[model samples]
Target: MTASSYPVLPDERLAAGVARLAVRHQGRYSVETVQRLIADSYEQLAANAHVRTHLVVLAERFAAERLDALAHIESPTGGERPRVLFVCSHNAGRSQMAAALLAHRAGDDVIVSSAGTHPSGAVDPHVVQALTEAGVALDEVYPKPLTDEIVQAADIVITMGCGDACPVVPGHRYLDWPVPDPDGAPIAVVRSIRDALDARITALLDTLPGA
Candidate 1:
């Protein structure tokens, strides 16, 4: 079917089921394009609570039916490693902390990235300071959008404060840790967040195969 005639799914389920339809029709579109279309259509069905409630199923289908084939599109020619994405409301606090701490502790065992639901362009100064104090040296960290490639590449997606804005892709492990925001907070509080994130990172490392 042409893009103009692309049927909008009724809700998440229908949106999710599009791949099955495509499979049945042996559609001309590539799986990547079809998955992108499905995601866009589902996001438009923003009215129903069932769509939100059924997100896990939708994500699962999206991953299995669509994402799995395209999951490592960003990796190197020889294939790299499993990635982890950390997301927060601003990408300036919790996500940055978690990502930095994980990278520091895990020592490149996993590829780690962080993003925002609504990015603020720069990492928070306090977050940088806290991480520096904790010896993480976050000189390269910057706020970025939560993209499809990032989500697909990540084996685990951790959301600290993005709430409902974080994308749910199927077949990936997702966690929402209700950590407090450290923007404009005092150094002590920032340090506390740093410590907390380090703890979480340690736990995450333990779950990894070679940790």
Candidate 2:
């Protein structure tokens, strides 16, 4: 709940994330405030990791995005909320989780799409189980490959381990979540990854400029 309660991180890692946030948001937020904000953000996503790699990076990103939203930042989309595309190696796992989570949480506030660089035959059974457990139905959704049209239209492109195969449109807001491939991971691991996505997605929706 407070910065002092932030999940423990290595001193250098914590300070780096804090300083990055403070400097990037220098004009709008003070260094002291950004430090607290980054710590709080780290706390928000800390519980979900089965292993705590890259928590600081994700936290800094989530914190900075929220701070931008608090300032009512505008984007290339102008008055409209963003349309986000989630891409991964296959549409079966991480991308599917992200798409479902964002849709469930954001509703009509944000448009959501997802695709894979190399399409699989169907959505992974475990991914479906995870979504069903969360009460978000997208059973009809299947593995689909990325398309230029969707990529061009998206206001934000979020790649979850898609690597070089992900499309790059010059004007879009591109972000790589660096989420691991969830293909063979256990249900518990999948859920933990889902929680991370929830943190990032919520922060993203919060940052969307309204129509």
Candidate 3:
């Protein structure tokens, strides 16, 4: 089959995302570099038969996540704090909210991360709005696939609705929050989920080693 079946088109959304990531890169690299990275990231998942659409949006997040990881691989905060990994059915809603809330509340006290057992094309719009309304910045995050390394690196792993999809790693602290998946849910429902997560995060913070 020819590559024509899988064309990489740079539309307005993709360009806008590239621009945002370029700014986030702090001029360390040119916009061209960031855009290329995003294109490459998109191609990484485009081959997956399961990923039918949303290639542009997923590329933006995957590229940003990869770049952010590269930016901090050698930083001093790499392993200084407790690392928490939030896993959900799709890393778009509950887990995203949890990480955002914890990161906001705990700041540098916790290294917060999130992923999906079955990754989604994008984050839930309602969840984004709820967190944005609650004052948690969601621009820097995108849904990502859960990997063994991320799970192993985390001091704590909280599962939302992933059930058996979430891996069980030895010596890794685990908690399963019975929070509803807010995908396609109404705004009020998303807000309730966000509030519940905020409370749970508050309690979780109290149990951390340094909290």
Candidate 4:
């Protein structure tokens, strides 16, 4: 009846090793029960990259649960729509593109977010240009670190190239798209990346609920 019973714990150091798990989740974890569950999940699945990834997913679920408990929060209730997260190593290129593309295409129907494993301070200008050329406004996009709350908030976590650096949470789906980095690439290449992502996002949209 607890998160600890789910699996065996990993070494404590692994928790520090896998730090790029969350995106921008703002949920607070003050409850002893929630902490226990997180710790238990972390310990049980410490050695498994996939299990750790599930832990990241669990973080999002917890965030949703926390939000549901708040009477003043304006977030939609469960099953209204699913949250999606896009992750890359820098949060500067591919992940940013994918997140923006999804948000643009999906609009308010889906919650979308993006982050980097080793996040740069700002998005790549080339990425900005590519998105702009693709017709998605780029004025409000900013680079952010991967965080536990963000991971916990997402129903889907898309990893670009972070591999094991991302975390795992149970009961969530994951997708990995091997998109190339467009930081310094020529406009042609950036456009290619954009087109590829657009196709992928279209396909992904087909999988979302009520799509």
Candidate 5:
């Protein structure tokens, strides 16, 4: 699609984000493609957003992730690291904690992503605090909706509490963790959930190829 046919973003900040992402993905995706994804990402997040202060930046990050997943799905390279996706009812609590914990433990041994069946406006504050106390860096973490490209790209899809909501794709390994949701829970409860996820992640890491 041509640039003229692309929908204009209401926020100039989002337009700028589109430009940055277009340049970052230059040669891989057309500006039009980047613009479309950014616009769609912004719309998706805005629909549930309670605070608009960081929406533009979060939209850019979300679009970047989708673009990367699309690239992985379109072009498969041998020896690429395993990709793990965590899913839950809301990306705010369980899934976010799982993804962060796995990423921290696995480092570059695995590629980690998380999404929600029904994404919330932000990551739950208690979730963030729990992760922070564990020394997991969550500066860029935010709740995002599950997307087709991401699901298709994952080598393993782990569901926390999303049940049948997470899409099923043939040949991708799927596991369901019956972990409790941390939303509205106190810090102590959130910490316990974090530790439970961490233990699961440690066991999961051992099963990966390199482990």
Candidate 6:
């Protein structure tokens, strides 16, 4: 019934991460809240992960994003930048590329996040290679499942081939970009998809409030 209701096996490994997050969000949330989110994030990511080497670090990063989203949703600040969420089926290719491309071009002008309806274990290699070729840093990027907090914090929800699985939040601008999936595609095709997403992001940025 609640986020805390999700089963989280106790792991001492997450203690350091929880402490860091608590201090980072000092006034905004309690230590228990950070611990709960970190545990939940670890569980969600570990569920379908193929490699567990960096799972703990990734979990910490994921939890931090969720906390930031939750903070934004709870507090209403004037002149806040528009938030955009990109969603695809696996979050391995299309959504990841779109989010990275948008963030690269948008800079600090917009808040960008991406997730999958059904997240894969890792990001597509081709997706990483293509973004790398385009000079966008893909460090710390990983496939993440959709969550209510992130969706609720978005000003625009862009769906790329995720179809009806993407959540529909009232008052948020929803756009469906029918882009081709680059799951198993070669580097060339992936690069083309990246360029296409870049073009789309360009157009979307122009329509944003401060643009």
Question: Residue by residue across 109-139, what tens digits does model 6's lDDT show?
Answer: 8999999999999999989989998899877
lDDT of 1: 0.67
- Which stretches of model 2 miss by more than 4 angstroms? 1-78
lDDT per residue as tens, model 4, 32-149:
3344444554432332232243444544343333333232234536666778889988788999999899989998898788877776656777888989988897645555556666
TM-score of each: 0.63, 0.61, 0.68, 0.64, 0.95, 0.93
Candidate with best TM-score: 5
Ranking by TM-score: 5, 6, 3, 4, 1, 2
Model 6, 198: alpha-carbon shift in Å?
1.0
lDDT of 5 by residue, 1-211 (tens): 6667887775778888888888888899988888889889988988888888888898889999999999999999999999999999889999999999998888888888999999998889999999999999976677888899999999999998887787799999999999999989999999999999999998999888764
Task: Write down the lDDT of every candidate, Cα atoms only.
Answer: 0.67, 0.73, 0.78, 0.67, 0.89, 0.90
Better of 5 and 6 by TM-score: 5
Off by over 4 Å in 6: 1-10
TM-score winner between candidates 4 and 6: 6
**For model 1, how does the per-residue alpha-carbon lDDT over 1-211 read when each residue is reduced to its tens digit?**
5755654444546544656645743544464556555655345323222225554344334334333324355333454556788999877789888988888887767777777777664677888888887778664555555667667767789988776788898888998887889998998999998898788887878787765
lDDT of 2 at 156: 89
Q: How close is candidate 1 to the true structure, as a TM-score?
A: 0.63
At residue 51, candidate 5 shows an lDDT of: 88
- Candidate 1 residue pairs in clash (backbone atoms < 3 Å): 59-170, 60-170
Query: What lDDT score is found at residue 31 in candidate 2?
Result: 70
lDDT of 2 by residue, 1-211 (tens): 5656654454347788777777777777777777766766666555333335666676676565556545543333356667788999878899989999988888788867887887665677788887888798773655555655567768789998877898898888998897767788898888888888888987887777661
Model 3: per-residue Cα lDDT over 1-211, one tens digit each: 3434333545546777887898999757566667767776666555442543666776787777666655554243633678888999878899999999999999878878898887776678888899999988765566777755466667789998888788898887999999988988999999999999999999999999764
